[model samples]
Target: MDDLVINNLSNKGIRTGKQYLEGLRDDRNVWIHGRKVQDVTNENGLKSCAHTLANFIDRQHEPKYINHLTYLDDDGDRCALAFKTPKSKEDIKDRGKSYYEWAKWSNGYFGRTPDYKNASLMSFASASTFLEKGIKGQGGKVMAQNMVNYYNYVRKNDKVLTHTLVNPTYNHQQGYKGKFSEKVALQVIKETDAGIIVNGARLLATLGPLADEIEVFPSTVLKATPDNIPFAFAFALPIATKGLRLICRDSYDLGKSHFDAPLSSRYEEMDAVIIFDNVLVPWERIFMYGEPELCNPAFSATNAVVHMMHQVACLKLAKSEFMVGLMTSIVKASGRDKDLYTKGLIAEVMQMTESIRALLFSAEEQAHEDQFGNYIPLRYPLETSRNLYPRMYPRMVEILQLLGASSLMATPSEADFANEISEDVEKYFQLSNLDSKNRVAMFRLAHDVAISGFGSRQALYERYFFGPPALMASSYYDLYNKDELMERIDSLLSE
Candidate 1:
């Protein structure tokens, strides 16, 4: 492939699904376990997932879905709805609708879909001044231009971005004493006329291997010392850039049939640690650099947290709805729908579903314009949903286990249904309404959702994806308005 053409393609209008898939065949440094993965598009554990994401890209071109998934830019070229910064209540609702469409495609299982980072990019672009505050010298104007340019590049090209914002874990004792390796967290190694050279690693890049670009930003508070200044930079770079490596975790997609490992088979958005070994981030890609004071507040200051959480709220609602559907199906298939305990468990799941749905509606209905004149979902409701869902998700999984019970354990693989003992298995496993094969398939899905490794990862992802619940709760408390209530109490006491 011609490097110049490849680099310049971002100026072209939106890529089709096929184009998106083809783009992933570029030279990217990716490793899974001990083996180097040559191409994620053809890797055994990653291809299906790559295709699933491609299908989402394709949805933008399909007439039936185009209206819901995309909108025309000011330049009159069609762009993804996810990239449209909401300026009105209707725009906020439309973005929510687009998020819903993508979330449903994965049944809310794929957490790092393109729309996730789209929210982030949109937020950063809308608040480009925040980037300016962090930049020094004559680079401030250049950095601000880079922000606009990158945002336009992504939105126009309909790029898929995965961000790595967490520092890799090293010995805390050593890190606190400034004795840790410079590579423990992503840091600028040197700056040149061309751009900045970065060498280090970042953790938990959810879709690192499959993404078109990788965003390295600050997610945690940083000390404003000179030692911490190197680690406070933020930038975006193409995944195909030389020396950028992705060390992936174990893939849950075990090449099992969809009938057996339903969720994992189609929706494993692989997480990996991103290592930048002297990776060159061109001048146009650097958003912020060397300002620790501004790094920590980048997300909050730009309102990116709220925008990203709004997308997450939509995804969580879909997940809750999926859990409800799965639980209802399990109860009916097992002929326990009439049982009081079963009804109660199902109701609990239903309540969770309705609660998330209500929060989603509230967030949109009460949406307010931010300082940038972009309409953002109600922060309080979205933050509350973020805090509550982490707690609710674990219980939802437990409910699935309870409702599934022995049926979940007794299920056989899809192959078993075609084997020599198929007759005996069918005779014994058949439910009253659902046939043996169908019943087993349903349980297999339940197992994938509640009992499998994929299920466990989902539980953990929900628990910590947005940081600690206690911190979020405290943040809500800190940010909430309490003056009116306190004043009313004082008035009553005085009277």
Candidate 2:
């Protein structure tokens, strides 16, 4: 372990926080609203979020956080904890701690943090056989090598990768059976000795503008037919790749002071629709191509979903914990902690927090070893976290709104406390315990969490982050085992 730590400290491939920031100054084509972003590193709407991620990277070199954020690899090179492929119970625990630590930086609001894709790459590396099995050709060995190389490249460099999995929903009413439009979804337009030329678009590439690379994969189920083959491919490319364009939604950062828009000001992870105009995906970058059958079960078959959700479970736990803190502080400051109704509401929030923590621990405790010898968190519990949290998150937001109540509306902006009406504002808004400024700040944070554009986006993002709740529940039902309960009932009837 010490060697691993030492190796990471000395590895050139491992980028410092400053290096990470500087790397984003590339000529990537990123358009927000109508304007093309020249440099994401310095863009006002993107720089703060990029800086937030850079801080996480910087922490790896800080003595206080280095151990918690990173580990030395088998080769004795230091790597981010998120890139570690768990081979034991301890490894999972260590990785979980790192995931929790990173999630805390954004209070679990930034969903596309580097750790998210790092876990995916770790999963892909562990289950390289899946990649080999999915591809058909004389180039099977070459494809396998590519997967290994890509995984190593990402882990070594600690690359920040954003993914676009779902196709645009433009013609969803026509459904999958109708003639598939080539222009609407990313598809292989031409194949060459150099690589494949991919064209069309994909939606919801969270953090696309700020990432080092963009990974494209299948998110929705696909038919195992020739018509869908062109769209079943998966690959990763540098964000600077020519002809690749990211058309972003409006910036939510709003340039508000941190005291005013606490979450959004620092954690606005921009989401965009990616358009590939004959983008070249090198042969070495392609993971799966011309295979819809493999694309559909890519997550389950590779156990990537479980690993990815392990990171998300840690994130949800952090979010719930943050909510618990917010609710407690709100109730205490408002002098409502003693109220039975208030206590009940706060307890409900606590229960949700503990529920997420319980699932996280249970999944780690009952960890299973995959065919590749990686110790993965138990699928059922992790999946349960993924399924239940979407439902729980909105309620958690509502509880904040309820606890804050009218106080949420009464708070003044940060400017009010700093300007001409400072004395008058402070006199009127000061709470019994918290200073007026602090009280206002707390409410401002609450408002950002509950009422602002940032707050609303967080709710909607969590709701459909893993797709529709009902579909996920039904899928879980179909995947889960019922044989034991049925057998017990049969035995009872026979007796």
Tens-digit lDDT string for candidate 2 (1-495): 121121133333468888888878888899986899988978878888999888877877888888878888887788888888888988888888888988887789889878889998889877887778766755555666677777787787777899988777667654445335666977888899978999998888888999988889876567778888888888888888889899988888988889888888989888888999988787778888887887778878888888899999999999999999998997788688999998998899899889999999999998879888889989899899999998899999999888888888887888998799999888998888788999988998998899888788889899987776876898899889999999999999999
Candidate 2 whole-model C-alpha lDDT, 0 to 1 = 0.83
Residues 133-208 of candidate 1: C-alpha lDDT, one tens digit per residue = 6566556667877787778878877788998877766776655453335747778889899788988888888888
lDDT of each: 0.84, 0.83
> Candidate 1's C-alpha lDDT?
0.84
- Spell out the clash pairs found in candidate 2: 4-72, 7-78, 8-78
Each model's backbone clash number: 0, 3
In candidate 1, residue 316 scores what lDDT? 93
**RMSD, candidate 1, Å:** 2.3
